[model samples]
Target: MKKYSLFQFCLGFILILGCVTWGTAFQNREAFRIGEITVSPGEMKSGYLDVPEKGGIGSRIPFTVINGAKQGKTLALVAGIHAFEYPPILSLYKIKKMIDPAELSGTLILVHIANLHAFQKRIIYYNPYDWKNLNRVFPGDPEGSISERIAHVLKKEVIERSDYLIDLHCGDGNEALIPYLYWMVTGNEKLDQTTKKMALAFGIKHIIIDKSRTKDLSQSKYLGNTSVLLSTPAITTESGYLGRTDQKAVLRNVKGIMNVMKLFQMIEGNPQFTEEPVWIDHYEVVRSDHDGLFFPLTEMGYYAAKGEKIGYVTDYFGEVVQEFYAPFSGMILYIVNTPPANKGEPVYEIGRVKEK
Candidate 1:
């Protein structure tokens, strides 16, 4: 048997007390920073993150930071990577108003609009100056074009700072889409699982078990994938379509983000996870080979059999130049609803559900 002294007991008691108080003390720590916005505990601030000028082209991204009363986790919600996707962009503005820092746990970063140039110009995917898709250029080049510069700033400011991230998006102006989310698998078990929970917590019924994103850091491509590859748990969510501003799609984005807040314990509530999630095992974005008018034979959210013609494209003179068919039996996640179809651009995306 070992004997203990009063000195040892007192020392042990003091250490225990320090550990207990340390947590509470750390929770009371001040300040959360991102871009130009710096928010103290129990406060919210909004500002712009400047993308430096490159060849007389520059833009400011709108952002809002809500620092919670107690420190826990930092969640970054980004919208408008593709400017024409209106619902997600609108959702962030609504969340900025709805969230009270006094009631939150950790900090909340709202990237109100990542593609301000595109949004201001009333455009879709590409940045007007460079005519390049903002989402396609990740970990952007500081010395590159306008879109590349925007990516660089976001990589340094937003994605690198957050513990969890959600890149909000929707179908562009030309497409019709059903609500769904991409749960990116990074081939890392812990990260993959965290993202899986986020997808379920988001409450979107259809979830793609997406493993298709490139592993190459230089060409990470999408914003969500860029975040994930950098070891942050992230998801890309789509909840609206056709450049519409309907309340339903907008609210869906808000609800999903709120539910994710619960999942991270950033708020005092349980996450409302999807009741029966439709697991999409595989997905393919069918691209057009010809520049012409597109006529869809099937609608978004409907099922298409393997080899079934989903749409067709005709030349400028109305000669059928090419036809698109489903590569596999799956659900039409999104399809071009408008007339224009260009070469090497997506006409539709199909997802095959995991069999029971």
Candidate 2:
């Protein structure tokens, strides 16, 4: 009788341990996350999906969407919207691993690499047919080519589904861009205020609040009145150039995105402010007048006075071909540091000060 009692006690203890283990496992299940999972622009039901186009061998597009524990605004983080841009996608990958969905109070959609076809082929975009730039084709066509179809689905499914958006990018091949964040101004007073606030929140220096003259309905403008008023504030990060990815720039961008999240109160933490960001509105593009071997005396982001010699162009024989000068008192926001230059090509972008 004593032996039977001991055996029963041991069995009871084992059962309790098993229940605790199972309970813990159930609590940790990833699906318990409040985030909804939907494959955009296609029916990709799992991570690392191979999307097949009509003509080419399909490419693999990997993505993950993590929602917060409590219901809140959905913020979409997308990279490789332009395929050749590597840093943003890498940053997205890092951001994905760092987030704990259980602690989130808002939805975070991460599209690490959007243009698989362009990425696989080492192309800047998926427009081999009409030679259209992919960035220009937003809110894409539903009944169009492969790129258009993909864009269409993205616009309808993802872009329309989010409260805020961030399109990450790097310089295309054959060009380099100084790290900067672009904020498009719609001339709307409220939006402009919100834009400035969001820009500061993101901690992006070298901000260009562009009041572009083009009236064509772009994705940013068109998406303003939908869910979240289709008026979601958007920003893009331009860092590094050509097929190269810089680790430092990537870190800067990652921190920048995190800063924005903190600003919006999506993340529970103190805001990281390493430096006071610089704000600039006037930008003047310096174009080359003739083809030559280009040589820059000064680097990008250097302040220069009006008519100051910034760089000089030379022929293959080392003879001075052309001398580039600052058009106004401003800082060289973006300079073509490449050794070669051609006529009518932009060499530097001078940020001139506007009289207040």
Candidate 3:
């Protein structure tokens, strides 16, 4: 009776092992295909997503894809939407090199530079050819401006292909900002919750839950919001400032991305979340009324009361042309660090913190 029981136990163990092996093989057979490249499991591939120009010449958006040995979720890490946002771009470069396909469970798509035109020309927010901000245009028109065409390609190619996305950013050349994240709270309850979890997992000290409902599609064309509308959970992050590439800021972004990877089970280990992140429900952008030199009275991350002086616009003679005041009590999300300012340009972004 004892010999018979041992034989049965061995037979059961072999069957379980065979099932596990077959499952893994099935997952490996499911390849990640994009732009004429198909990456099988445990493989890493790098290429560019081509964007054609007016003269038939074209530019390419550099990308790297890592298909993990085990099947799980695909996470897309994108940066350099604005040319001057160096930290996030640098982090993506480092991350692509560090991640091993054998260790990852799913796939990671890394776009090192989204706006190659702006990046190469050292332009700030807008693309040089179209003079339009890439971030503001999404699901773009094929026959539109160069910027719009790039946006359309990204939406159809990169964004649509991913299960989740992390759009990384830093302050433009003329701005200083505190590190924070913007998580869109769409009407989709499940997606909103998942995005919130991803935001918290990013390990940022401040989080802004954007709950704005816009009738115009242009108003909601931001990359993060557009991704959410497409049924993908996404989050946008801000870290470095003044167009400077600080290693500390770059490392922070790298670590935060790794944490998100863990949260999605693409990698192992638990995410280290902030003990309590300051949550804000809404934010307002303070724009200058006159073209002049901007003199900020307050710093980034400083809390201000309603009607408090946040900054001022001065003429060439140093005379105050316009005094900017906070419209509501809130924390300073970002501020203009560049001395020069233009009419209708943003001076500061203030967020109303939610009370516990």
Say which candidate scores most in TM-score: 1
lDDT (10s digit) by residue, model 2, range 1-356: 34568888999999999999877754443332212444222112225433445565334456677756544566777788677778887888778777766666566777777777677768764455444455656555655566655565566656776768777776655455667766667666786666566666666666776665244544532222221234676666677676677787677668877777776677788776536666667777788887887777777678898989988888778899789888888877667766778777777777764444
lDDT of each: 0.92, 0.65, 0.88
Q: Which RMSD values do the candidates have, in order? A: 5.5, 7.5, 3.4
Tell me the TM-score of each prediction against the true structure.
0.92, 0.72, 0.92
Specify the highest-lDDT model's number.
Answer: 1
Cα lDDT for residue 178, candidate 2: 68
Question: Where does the lowest 10-residue lDDT sum fall in candidate 3?
Answer: 212-221
Per-residue alpha-carbon lDDT of candidate 1 for residues 1-356, written as tens digits (9 for 90 to 100): 78889999999999999998987776676788776667888899989999987677789999999998876799999998998999999999999899889889898989999999889898988989999999999978899889888999999999998999999999998889999999999899999999999999998999999999999889998889999999989999999999999999999999999999999999888898898999999999999999999999999999999999898999999999998888999999999999999999999999999998
How high a TM-score does candidate 2 get? Answer: 0.72
lDDT of 2 at 202: 68
Candidate 1's TM-score reads 0.92
Q: Put the candidates in lDDT order, highest first.
A: 1, 3, 2
Candidate 1: where are CA atoms >4 Å away? 1-28
Clashing pairs in 2: 223-230, 224-229, 224-230, 224-231, 225-229, 225-230, 226-229, 226-230
| Candidate 3, 152-207: lDDT as tens digits | 88888888999999999988889899999998888778999999999999999899
